[model samples]
Target: MKTRSCFILMGRAVLALALSFCPLITVQAVAAETASASALENSVVKVFSTLRGPDPYKPWSKAGPQEVTGSGVVIDGHRILTNAHVVGYASQVQIQANGAGDKIPATVLAISRGMDLALLKIDDDSFFDSHKPVPRANVLPDVRDAVLAYGYPTGGTSLSITKGIVSRIEFVRYNYPVSGLRIQIDAAINPGNSGGPVIAGDKMIGLAFAGALNMQNIGYIIPNEEIDLFLRDEASGTPHGKPAMFDTIQTLENPALRTFLKLGKNVEGAVVLAPFSKEADYPLKELDVITHIGDFPIDNQGMVKLNANSRVRFQYRVQQLAKNGLLPLTVVRNGASMKVSLPVSSSHPMLIPSLAGNYPSYFIFGPMVFSRATSEFMNVPNGNPQILYGMAFAGNPLMTRRGDKPDAQREELVVIASPFFPHKLMNGYSTRFFSVLYSVNGVPVRSLAHLVTLLRDQTDDLLTFRFEQRDAEAIVVPRKEMLAATESILTDNGIRSEASPDMLKIWNEKTPAGK
Candidate 1:
């Protein structure tokens, strides 16, 4: 009987091996887990948007209608929260509840593109009766915490769920509307997962918005803090936007640099490189060392303590302030400590306007097309180096200002958008594309409208166009001949108007009567 006891142990081991090889058992386990996750489907919805935006190159026309899909979650007040990019420039928006067939019409109530969040209201209140709003978490989640992403990701119709963990939480650049703070996770956030909720233990910790293309399983979330700021702004009835820190700053990490600034032993701060705009005139100057913002003391890395254990970039404090509010600062200047207040607002009098969504304003005079130089234009392939340099260094006082010469007073860069089309009036000149216009008839071209005004008032037979270059190329044309060919050029190019609608209005308001 003792020798036969080995048979019982072998039999038990054989039974365990049989269970491990059973596919049916594993299938049942996965099915059970999926059933448990289905409860979250009610709070998520699929968003469909139809967008039509203006064409940047063709200012007078609009781009074709486009259909896009995203995800949204029900929030308080019978409103839905989604990414701003999903509904931006949208002509119509429709929301479909998970596992439902009807698509309810919705409208954007408020949108903050800078934060990449938008709120929508359904046309029918009954839509909310069946779905429950997801609860938002009060604080950020810790690293390695398990999270579930619920959305209608691409490649399927029904709601999808993917399990992941909190990978990182820090200040990361957001792609849309430029960069800002963002959260990262090691989840499969795909094309249609945008605006979906990242749930941790039945509470929403983050909103899935973007993902890294180069790396696998890396996604970004618009954290709850930014969402709260947007909601607060909406409730205040006077939302301006996130406050901007216009002062360019660098860390005083080098010991020699710190010693030169008289930052004795433990003093840590960031050195001001330059203030970008005049509106930032809290009298901030170059070489000023910023040691404190509000009550937060900044370290040499340009970071401030968010908590006893966590620290964030110094700009986070500025972003927390209300727009147009005053921000207090402690700075070391000329080896002396001083306190100052800086206005909290975005840059104004911008020399380079963003052309991401808006159309570029343009005016056509005969064969030459005049348009304002913008960041979009500067990015054109194989663009003029001089024009790009001029546009880039236009406002930097350190680079543009020389000896008693005041900062370049030109407010906008007006450029010839196209190479000279063959015409008798434009002959005898090599018309380079993107040549910045310096002056018209001895008058400095301040802006596009100013150039138009200068041209409108010109009584001389020969109209001279001076360009901003080392050679200072000049283009001379007969005024009467240039005026006579405008209509023909418009007709040949299939352009409906001589100038953009805004430019036409400007010309009408500024041009003299009966000229």
Candidate 2:
């Protein structure tokens, strides 16, 4: 979707006509409206941030600095509330008051990248003395309720206010966090308007964040309920990334399937296809039908009512729980009804991680570069489809488990990142770049660190590296010759270090116990 950028320019002809018809308007009513708008404007401020993000392809390097501008509102606890994307990688932040010329320094105090919310603290306490925090509304505004969007959009140095109405409130996917539950409004959400407050009278109802690319005047806002959750999570002082259900569920809308599952007449629920986590205590099982999540009764479409007027996906109910809490679920398994307590926590680990935090992890031994498979890696051109499929289905218990060994379940996938230049040591070897590793010297590689340990602990004369594809032959290398060529390879390639800094740290910590 296209991000809204640049301020909207108003036509001079429309302005002239409005001025010409000004005599028809009541002076008292206009005065009261202006006064109310001015009061709300005081809480809004412009945010400027300088960011430097890491390069995904070259894990050892960092990208150039980038400058971004957005808007924020003063919230409770003397903090400024804005979008996480605005200050996520910010090295420096400055806040400009609505009508002030001076820009005060600020620091990010708490951030939730998943929720796209961040809280900032002003360096000087005096800023709060003049600007008051806007109170959040406890209840969501009704559809078509009049609202105002306050921010410093593009092309304007001063605060700009736009009048609009709440067009819709539903569970729409939020682009940043890749989650759902958003508010749609017709007010324009230009680039500079991000993080600004959506005001309904005196209370703040939402935060302007994203806009639709294919449609006009379609902007999105983070609803007050989600903002409340973000603030509460920060107040807890513990990082709980994001709460997840950890199960793949499907709607039980098919009457035939529902009947085959023995669901009672008029019963509504969703069927669990698989639980992502392999933990023994995981509550849900395949084919189990979830009838209720907490007090909300799920319908055949896998939706639950938020109130009498609104219903959203059942996952929303799970998102409301605090970390490490229990989500009570009512399920029907094999025609028997039972209550199950599912643990509420962040996403479980997979062979390939969905989100690679700031930098990816990698280790380079001679010309062979080994790195953990991640979503970023899969996006590279000419990636192996088989490896991608394995990563995608890594959550399946049967697929992840290797052979009959109890410890054969791999937690992560390590792959050959790229093809190394022709070398005497690797002669006659046809490398399969991006291929998943099978084992080294007959021992399974569970993680990237495990591979390091396996190589370090090897006592054989030659190392045997196997790939996942059966047709691919093993790569055999003489230990002594390979070790002698490592330094030459590094020097020829002008690599400052053999491995990334994080890998060096892991190697140091994993050094043999008494060595």
Candidate 3:
């Protein structure tokens, strides 16, 4: 009788407490929500970008304008952190504070194309004092922990905030040929939500970047660690973030390749099908089997299981090793384990000397095109044989072929096409042999930088091209002659007008101000 009475009394006490503070709990919740709303409005900034599109086939036509919208967080008084792709190839860029209508023009400060991170600075001085800078958190949270993403999503935005949990800490690839430490979140990251803050409590943990195209609620962010590295590299005046390539042995899937190398099932190693660059030749070989990179052993599946329970595949091993250019690796050949050093140099040799802001020379005097043969276009057979010269290294050429066994004894010439050519011309050309070019008219070619410089200096009545080719005489083609022929052919085929943009700069800078 006493125990039963005690239980009844305890239950009645709980009911009395719940009834007494129900209204008070509701009031506190409302107050807290109001405070959060005010903070979000003050923290988020709206990004405005001017995008451009051209006729894919025309080279002399102008481009049309488009608008891109996104969100950003001010991490420092002068600098804003965001994704590189958000503002890439943009013609104009500006930012708007929450509740403000005026757009403040912004200039890109620096960009890490390999990592997809960009730093921008708004020209307005008032922005520094108006927006409070959010502090970056050094320590990340554990899985299943709550986090908030603040951005101007597709929905009505005073600064839309979404809540989700940490899903994974993975070493996954974001874009092809670029991979690194990635934070996978269960947050809904959509079109306009990119470049926003992924915050925990009051601190920022990462920048929202990419998402799984086929999956729902699966998005990826570049961790604060990478952000910190970017800032550090900026301070030290070093190129941003980890290396882009690595030098390691590849484990081929072909059974005949394994048999040719005299390897058995008991062998635990990978074959070196190709080297990253010429520098890698000092330490790597065509048939060498790689056993390790640093202290991590590579399995037959080409997976390198790190000591920390995380795993990274060897597919991008060349890029990672190229981060420093002087990376060390361990390999096993014929049951012998040995250490080797590899050099991370430019894969394309002839283009390296000319890549530093110089344009190839070309002259348009009569009716012919003049340009030089580059290593870029000549390495392939039957692709762009018009301008190929030399056959010195006849076996395995570097970068001519994307993959396969090394042939160190092969050589080929490079070629280039005019920017104003018909887009249909590229349809049948499946290989890169026709792509290597330096100049159009008396202009020195480096990268595409020559194109912008040449276009701006276009004052000549005729454009002449001088190209290098093996066996065939170096020929000069005139611009007007080609144009007349092109016009006549197009008119006959009932086609008119071209889509190529003549005024646009083709350099890969994210913002127009970058040039």
Candidate 4:
């Protein structure tokens, strides 16, 4: 304790000596920083949203209304910019200024769930009269630059400003299947800190969007580059998402890998384990190493130099350099070096897809309820890893077919969304909830719509359902009797809709000649 106190005293003495030598310069710098921070506080806002998130467990209806709070900041063009997650699926949204007593209602003018960005328009333009947009820095800030994170984070009613510095920056994943430039800071970004502004000097550098989970004194911000792209894309009426490559990749840092690829010693870039598309004419394929994105050379770690000290993943350059969804790349294939115009896309089809704040499509039969398998639904077993292991042991498609892309015949895996509804028809049946439907009767279940159609057009005496499991029993139901009792079951269960709108349309579609 004495040693630490002595060090602290020595530091204070050194500071006092420096202050005495240049008191005016020191005071002026401090005053300038303080004024800058104070000006930015007025622009920050508290965002309140009433969101109706999808209920994957009960696909028939949405979950209860949830009131969530986050932060936002006024940007250029009389718009309020915030994180997409802050207001995604929001039914109602309102914003309150730093010390304002009344809330101003706002509507989402544009939103990008992939990039986690949204632009809001307020009903009252007079709100901007008192709150002016803070000047934003055009360029990225350097590491170690002092920053002030302003927001109404949880545990406070008013705006909270936390002092920190730029820790690091990288091109990393934001939401699933989306990647962008993210800046990490040493500030304490709490729950409500999301969508707030991170100020440096006299301008705003980024918005605090997320915090590092399970870590202390670490938070992440969305830099101006991403926000600018979102703003420009939103202006086009139809939002064209940020382009990215979802191809399977791996770093080429191993000596054996280089020797196998016949790569030269000086060669540096990430090697492609598998290309995104399997088409014959696709530009990329297995063993093709990506050497450069546009003109920026990539390192073995799949990183491109952003500046003198900052390096981000080569994929980040795809968003900036891509033209008409074509990203220029330098590739080395079979010891031949050449340039390729890689066709990148903003979306990827997966067997189990992310819900993206949308409700899952569902179709409920006599007793069994089925819905499209989604990433959120699959994660329901997270509370018990043992259940996941059990599913894996039982050959659950949810565990096996994850990360797989859709094919011609099978586009999605349909799962038993919920346990059997209360009905005498469901009596004596074992629980088959969460099982992937393999087939119905004698036909393969291609999708939820297909399953509904098969059930609707059934003529057999018995309806047999097979699941994708090793130890599962075939569930047989009295076909005509089950269909007859569906209405009564719905009444007993109080289920208003027989199926989701899309599935209902397929159910009501005309049957073909031979069934």
Candidate 5:
């Protein structure tokens, strides 16, 4: 009897509470919302940095300093998290919270240029006294969910919140060769918004990193799941990058392809167009059909179910389930089902590698300068499309072989980094500023070190410089005169060292030429 009366009383209370809604209730609700907004705003910060980008055109020095600003947010460790590009090559970095007058000195603790994320450490613990970490959601944000992005964009000094809805979510590429989960939103993400938090209700779904300025209603954020992986990896002394498979793959969408594979109607997945390697022992084989990653069944489109209504590329699971540089996959070879443990890696060498926050390595040989071919080198000519197209017309290796993989014949591509200095040694030589050095004295130039070694121990009467591409002009110079002229070239050009540190070490080594 007492329990029944208690239930009746609770029902009456609920009715009374519903009837009590009035101006007082409205005032309290507004006040609660105001407080919530204040908390999120307090966590947003404006980051200032003075950065110096690499000068590939002049490998001896870096570019001039430039002031840059971006947004960041406070995370679990009381540290400021922002995009790597904002603070890259930064000589000084500071942070100012929303409404705060003074900026606090901060240091970059770690950075992942591939992921475009960076962690900043502030010595002053007082900065966190008023700022609190925004809670992060572990799952991907649902499409069309209302989102609020907080950042300090240009044309404003205060924290700005732009409203939008989640547009799309997918595993996408960030920097070259590095990919992660990215969420697209219709939010007007602008300059200076990078690293700002994208909040869905009370939890943060991601950080703004990119925006399509030419297109409307398009912006992208690095999801919290990727951020969590970066943080965990940073916690370890050595951050083994995200485990991934880089081999070529093809969709199993064509009916003819299915028939060619002799696959049953029940079987579906992606087909391996080609293996990443030629070794007979390589686990993956050309024409192999991958049906599953771990236990998740991959569809004919090379996609897997991420949630009840979400499907993403099967490679997404590799970032999640890869362990100890290995990933498990179910493969059907010659229509026979088998389990395969495939090797995965966070990164691999490229023929022309990115600078990745480091300066370019270079060596000076008399009037000519040589450096490894880099992505930055290619970008320098980007400002002038004529030069790039001309190189393309000439079939320059930097353009023709940019995508080629490093092999036994060549570990690195050494290119002429700069124009020749004014000297008699190159009086008649044609200007081939960016040509790939093929050989010296008919010996194949494998790397910058090999080129330096070949040049250092040269005792020939005449040195012939051959380039990699066909129809390239070759130059012949007097060996002894060029060698003796290098010292004067260094003094005449105001160059402190003839080579970079690594090349200098190689040049100074007394080892025999082949050794």
Candidate 6:
């Protein structure tokens, strides 16, 4: 009986030892998985960009280089995901792997300015083999959920991952202050962290884009949906379509127009300052009041009030378009409400480009350069006297989020300028498009091509250019020396590229080959 009892005790002890060892083996497996992930992080890299100047013209200048730093995640063997603004205008770009020597050369694959997302491609892919592209989780994490932001920040060189929570997911512009989109997270993001990945539970929820300068611990991201859209656009060759533009708009400042709409008590509408080319097609007049956009009501200040109790007014119709691009509008004319289809155009009325394309074609005579009127170059103020009298129309909207004020003094629309103009018209030609130039001897000044053609054809000691400006001014430029004088003036003003119609012309082409 004693031998049997001893055998039972020995068997029970062996069973207990086996159970304990099983748990130890499981813990070791989990630790190994975590270590593997840490090793995969080496695939991520840091991107640095250096710009020569504010303009693209002097991109290779030796002046102090303006540097921008951002984070990038390896999406594939050779591709990285980042923010467009981080390297969009960069003249030179360098990418550094965690343990690599000199940075690698990188090129932009695609960019979505509205969404603030960009894709980059590198030459080699050997650095990432066992890596996996972070999966896009369908469900959005609620506010206050645990979140992680991975990137290379200011202090350290290698990958830095910070932990935080989702404070909110509101429709806010991720980069541009005037625009807004859906973003998540309460992570504290800084300058160098712009293009990093915002992860939740080992899944990519969004891409870090911007942070509020006035607020602490506040950052924004581009959600995974935007990333999907960008990838699809890359396959399609073109991204999302650009917003449609209208030509005329008006300020809501006049008391008569405001009182007619009963705006002071309960204001609602955008005022029709003047029409672009299409204004003649609508019943809108200079003083016509625009009360509602689609269903969004306007306030007395000519602003579309969104969440009025919150006191937020939007300047561009683009914001409304971004909210919902297709919507009807209600306009008030002579104290009567009339519904009209709202055309999408520039917020300023006078600058609407009657010319085709975003950039205008230019004609150059020796040094004298001329371009047609476009929405961007026009800076006319709202409610011009000519508009009120029904003799004039604006090419842009009346209100905008641009730096120029609605009350800015407008110059006349000049299309022609020449030294042979009557001295009286020449005095004010600089102020209007009436002084813009078209051609030198019918060379068809359609682009930089026309300019180059004319320069090569120059043999006459005295050259003449036919000029056309608004307000019925036609001028002829004579004497080749006068044209040379104009070139000197342009160079002194730091205007290097005469091809672009906009003042911010950076890209230039001296010949067709250069283009």
Best by lDDT: 5
Q: Compute the lDDT of residue 24 as modeled in candidate 2.
A: 59
Put down candidate 5 lDDT per residue, 1-515, tens digits, no spaces: 99999999999999888878776789999999899889999999999999989888789778999999999999988788999999999999999988889999999999999999999999988778889998899888899999998899988899989999998889878898888888999998998999999999889999999899699889999999999999999999999878888888999999999999999999999999988876898899999999999999999999999777678899999988888888999999998999999999987788999998999889887788999999999886767889888788888888888888898899989999999888888887787788999999899999999999998888778889999776678989987777678799899878888888999999889743432
Q: What is the TM-score (0 to 1) of candidate 5?
A: 0.93
Kindly give the number of clashing pairs for every candidate.
0, 0, 56, 0, 0, 46
Ranking by TM-score: 5, 4, 1, 2, 3, 6
Residues 170-190, model 4: lDDT tens digits? 998888788999999998899
Candidate 4 Cα misplacement greater than 4 A, ranges: 1-38, 511-515
Q: Which lDDT tens digits does candidate 1 get at residues 79-146?
A: 99999889988999999989889888999999877678999998788777878788899897877889
lDDT of each: 0.77, 0.77, 0.59, 0.88, 0.90, 0.57
Give the candidates in order of lDDT, highest first.
5, 4, 1, 2, 3, 6
1-515 in candidate 3: lDDT tens per residue? 99999999999999999989999999998889787656655767878888653321222222477788888888775788888777765678898888887788998787765577888897776777767777778876667768888787766656777889988776666543356678778888887888889988767889898778989999888888778767776777856345544444566556787688777776655677765555534677667887766656677767775334445575445444544566567876665768986655433233312211122333211121223333222334335443322322322122344332223222222233333334332233332223434245755444333443453355454554433222222233433454445555445435443112221333222232311
Model 4 / residue 32 / CA error / Å: 8.1
Per-candidate TM-scores read 0.81, 0.80, 0.61, 0.91, 0.93, 0.56
Candidate 5 weakest lDDT stretch, 10 residues: 506-515
Model 3 TM-score relative to the real fold: 0.61
lDDT of 5 at 400: 85
lDDT of 2 by residue, 1-515 (tens): 13332222245567878998777577767888887667678889999999876554555455589999999999878899999889987889999998788899999998877778899998788788878888889898887888889888878899988889988778744532346578888987888899999988778999998778888888889988888878776778876665767578999999899878877886789999987556787889889999988777899999888766677788887776543577889998888889988886664455566442466777766557787766566665326667546544543222343222223567677778767645877778886566778788888788788887776666687888887654567888876666567678778767676667777677666443322
True-vs-predicted CA distance for residue 430, candidate 5, Å: 1.4
Model 3 spans with C-alpha error above 4 angstroms: 1-41, 52-62, 139-145, 172-176, 238-241, 246-271, 278-281, 297-300, 304-309, 314-324, 345-515
Candidate 6 lDDT tens digits, 1-515: 89998999888889888887998998998888787557546656799987543211121122356788898877743578898777865678778876677788888887765567788887676645644465666665666778888787888787887788877655544332223445656678887888888888767788887778888888877767557656765778754433333434656767775666565545455666665343366545666677776667777665653332232333334434533344366777666777776544223333323222122454433334444344333333233555323223322222222233222222222232223222332444343232333455654354334444565445655444443322433334444455445455556646565444432232232322211
Output candidate 3 Cα RMSD.
Answer: 10.3
Lowest lDDT block of 10, candidate 1: 397-406
